[model samples]
Target: MKIDIIKKYNDVRTATIDFCSHLQIEDFSIQVVQFASPAKWHLAHTTWFFETFILKNYVKDYKEFDADFNFLFNSYYNSFGDRILQTNRGNMSRPSIDNVFAYRRYVDAKMQDFLERITDEEVIDLVILGLNHEQQHQELLITDVKYMLGHNPIFPEYHKDFNLIKDQNTITNTVKIQSGIYQIGHQADGFCYDNELGVHKVYVDDFEVNNHLVTNGDYLEFMESGAYSDFNLWLDEGWSWVNKNDIKAPMYWHQVDGEWHNYTLAGLQKVDNDAILSHINFFEANAFAAWKGMRLPTEFEWEIASKELNWGERWEWTNSAYLPYPNFETANGAVGEYNGKFMSNKMVLRGASVATSKNHSRATYRNFFNPTERWQFTGIRLAK
Candidate 1:
C-alpha cells in the first residue's frame, strides 16, 4: 500500500497540538530542567524544522517565517548556525504561546500546498524524515510536559485520562534464545533513522531473557533491600550521582505519609505495583541488574529476542553503547548531523515506551541517552 504522505503529515502535526491541548498557558513554557525543551519551544522548533529544511530547500520561492526564529529554535545544528542553548529554552517568552500556535498553522498551510504540488522522490523523502522527526518530538513533548507538571510542588494534572491497564508480567519465566547469526539494523522497506542504517550480520550468543518488563513492585523490592546505600552495587559514577542528587527513589516518586505515591498524568496517586518501572536512569538500571546478579541485554540480543516478548511498555536500556554499525557512512548535508553526532559515551535503549507515538517504533530501532539521564520513561529488562 502506498503511504498517504499528506494524511500522515497532517495526522502527525495534529497529534502534537492535541498532546498539549490540556496545558495551561503557564504550562506551555515550563522547563523544569535542562534536558527537556519547553512545550512551546517544541512547537516552534518542529515547525522551524519543516520551514527551514523542507519548505526552504524544496519549495520554490519560499519565504522564511520571522528570521529571528532560526537562532531561537535551531537545536544543536551547528552547521546551520549558532543554536539557542538547550538550558535557556524556558526564557523565550516573546514568541508567546498563541503566536507559536499561529506559527504552526502558518507552516502547516504552506506544507500542505508544497506536498500537493511536489512530485520529486527526494523531496518526498525529506518530508518523510520531517514527519518522523515530528513524531519523535511528539513523544518528547509529552515526557517534557510530564516532567514539568510532576516537579511542581502544587502538582497539576496535564489531563485526567490515566486509564492504566494491568500488566501480568513474571519475574521468573526466562525465554532462552539460541545462538545464531542474526541481522541487525533497518533492512525492511520502510522509514527509519540514519543511525539504523549499515544493516549487517552479527553473531548473537545463546542467552536467557525475561518475558515481562521489570515492574514497580520489583524495583520496590530492590529499594527496600537497601540497594541505594550499597556502593558495591553501583558504578563509581553512579554512586557519585546517587550521593550528589540525594537520590532515594525514581523521579516523580515520593513517600507521602509513610505510603508510596507517584505523580501521574492524572496527578499524584498511590503507586501501582503491577505497572512496569519507569523514570530510572541507565545507572540505576545497571546497578539494579548487579544487585540481582543479572545484567541488561545487548542491543543485538534485544533485537533478536524482541519478537516473542511483550515490549513497548517502557524504553528498555541495553548494556550496549550507542555506536554506529560496522563501516557506516554519514550522509552529506544538515540531515547528516541527526544521529551520527551523538554516538559516543551514550548507552543505547531498545523498544518504545507508553509515551511513544503509536506506530512509531520497531525491533531494530535504537534510542540512546546519557548514563545519568533519567527524566524520560526508561526502564530495564534482565538477561544472563
Candidate 2:
C-alpha cells in the first residue's frame, strides 16, 4: 500500500510539471483575472501544501526550505499565518520561475523521503489529501492558463497536442429517474473531502434529465433565438448580470465575419457544433435551460442519474446552492478551512471536465463557483 501511494504521489507531481511543459516563462505569470491564479503560483502553493502539512508535522527537525515561502505561498489558511493577497499573486514578478521549480524539487525530495518511512495511517491520509489537493490545482493550472491565453489580444496556441475541446456529447436521450428517498453524498470506502462526508437521504421528485450534455450546436440555436437579448428567459440576478457585463455569448466565444469561433488550448478555431458546450457560467446555463423551456437539474438529480448517463465531458452546473449536507462538520485546524468556509454564495456543479485529472472526479464530487465564474470548463445539462 505504501509503495502504491508513493507511486501515485510521483505520478501526480510529475503530471503537474508535464502539463506546464508547453508553457513559456511569460505564460507562467499570466493571470488576467483575480479569480484565476498563475501557473507559477499553483506550482509553489501545492509544494507549500506538502511542506507545511506533511513534512512539518511528520519529519522531525525538518529544515525550512525558505522561511519566506510560508508567507508567499500560504493560500487562504488564516490559521497558517499571514499571506499575500490572491489578487496580488499576479504582481509577484519575483520568486522567478526558476525559483518556483527549485522550490518544488526541494520539497518533493523531502516528501519522497517522508513517504517511504512514514507508517502512521493518519500521516498517510494527509499525504493522500495533499496529492488530491495538487490534482485540483492541476486542473486549475490548465483552465487558468487557458483563461489568460484566451483573453490575450493575439490568441496563441498553448500546444497543438493539447486538444481540450475534442470530447463529443454522447447521450441524446432523457433519462427517467423515479422519485424516491435516495442516499446522497460519498458512501464509498475511499478518500473523499469533508464536504462529501455527511451521507444522508434526499427526497427528489420524479424528473427527466438529458443524458447528453448541451452541445455547442444546441446553444447556437439558443443564441439564434436572441435569448441573450430577451430578459424574460433570465432570472432576475442573471438578467442584471447579462446587461451589466453585456454578456452576449459564453466566455472565449467570438463572432468573426458572422461565423462563431471560440478559443481552445490549441488556439482559436471555429466552434464545433458537435462538441460539448463549455466555459459557460450558471447564469447563462440557467438562461439557456429556460430558453429551451426546461431547467438545470439539481445536484441530487445529477448524482442519482449519473451512473446511467455519460458525463465528465464538462462540469455541468446544477440548480443547487453550495451548502453543507445534514450533519456536516468542518475538520479542525487550518485544514478545516478547505471547503466549509466557501459554502456560501456559490452554486454546485457536478461531474468532471476535460481538464480534470484521472480519478480526481467521482459521482459525489461537488464543485462550487460563483454564479458568474466562467473561466473553468463548465457547461449545462437540462432537466424538467
lDDT (Cα atoms) of all candidates against the true structure:
0.88, 0.92
Task: List CA RMSD, all candidates.
Answer: 1.6, 0.8
User: For every model shown, what is its TM-score relative to the native structure?
Assistant: 0.97, 0.99
How far off is residue 172 in model 2, in Å? 1.0
Q: Which ten-residue region of model 2 has the weakest summed lDDT?
A: 162-171
Screening candidate 2 with a backbone cut-off below 3 angstroms (N, C-alpha, C), the clashing residue pairs are: none
What overall lDDT, based on C-alpha atoms, would model 2 receive against the true structure? 0.92
Regions more than 4 Å wrong, model 1? 1-3, 163-172
- lDDT string, candidate 1, 1-384, tens digits: 124999898899999988788888888887888988899999999999999988888877888878889999999887779888899999977889998899899999999888888788888888889888988998889888888888889888877775232344654567899998998889888889888888899998899999778888999999999999999999999999999999999988999999998888888888889888888999899999999999999999999888887788789999999999987889898899889999999999999988888789998899999999887788889999
lDDT of 2 by residue, 205-287 (tens): 99999989888999999988999999999889989999998888889999999999999989999999999999999999999
Q: Report clash pairs, candidate 1.
A: none
Give the winner by TM-score: 2
Q: Give the Cα error of residue 312 in candidate 2, in Å.
A: 0.6
Superposition TM-score, candidate 1 onto the true structure = 0.97
